[model samples]
Target: MSLPLPATGTKRADRHWWQTACIYQIYPASFKDSNGDGFGDLPGIISKIDHLKSLGVNAVWLSPCYESPNVDGGYDISNYRKIDPRYGTVADIELLIRSLDEVNIRLIMDLVVNHTSDQHEWFRESRSSKTNAKRDWYIWRKGKSITIGNECVRTPPNNWKSQFQGSAWEYDAHTDEYYLHLFAAQQPDLN
Candidate 1:
């Protein structure tokens, strides 16, 4: 798509268009269901563009609709470049963007770069071994061994608590190390 031209006679110091845009946030799963599949999809969102226009929405802040395990309400993204089948396909997203653009509405997709699903290829390879090329892509640390009830137990590297409760680090038996997750263990923190 071509870059939007700046408004005529608008000074650089002036507030940008987005500074005053009326953005409407949409969580696809709970917004509208187009196929009766019990989940909202991109097509369903497209079907409501008229309603959004009537509501004077100048932009849409779409929540993550990327391929995910839905462990944290689709925040555990398994793939960053692909759309989840539960929502729709890449074409659907393209159409949505184009449709929104046609009506002078901007599309803002929510991207979660802080962490990725443990099922993601990057995380999988990172946890494969300490020497894996992508290993440094995530935060991994050795745990402190403590004696507990006659048996040696490995505790998290630090006393950091996860937002979802419990230790923020999850021990990986394969690599004999712990990976940090600020949220759920399924969503490992990316370095």
Candidate 2:
């Protein structure tokens, strides 16, 4: 089933720029590495503004480059406000934005909010204790306990599976609870 296209000769101002923009996705880790660190960084991206413009790119969707433990390829961000040191600093990102703006190219960041790195301050506090002030920020449950052969064992909160495979819940011995993780064990789902 084909959808009807917009009427020809429609005024450009009548539609959102994104409706007809040429967007390019850049995985900063694999893009140009300006520092020779073997990983792409913001400065590297900034250095390619001319290349992006020459490619007729109107927008760039940058993958996550937030501070993380790299357990989930930066998707498990430890800090949402800070850029990973390996990728450069916040100032570098600001420069990248301005550079892209110079070429009329928009910048879109891949912000992962559904879950955060286990090392994230919020997640760390949430997992510290059941009564932690931020405990409710993440999904936690007391999994069922089963007796097997004379030993008692705790199982996951449920039989749900993770997208990356195995159980979706990780057992926290400190809190004696199972936290939900849709992706990696290090990434717990936000409440």
The candidate scoring highest on lDDT is 1
lDDT of 1 by residue, 100-191 (tens): 99998999999999999999999999999999999999999999999989999878889999999999999999999999999999999999
Model 2 clash pairs are none
Task: Report RMSD for candidate 2.
Answer: 2.8
Which regions of candidate 1 fall more than 4 Å away from where they truly are? 1-13, 148-150
Question: For every model in order, what is the number of clashing pairs?
Answer: 0, 0
Q: lDDT of each structure?
A: 0.95, 0.93
lDDT of 2 by residue, 1-191 (tens): 96566689988887678878899999999999998879998999999999999999999999999999999889999999999999999999999998899889999999998999999999989989998999999999999989999999888878999999999999998998999999999999999
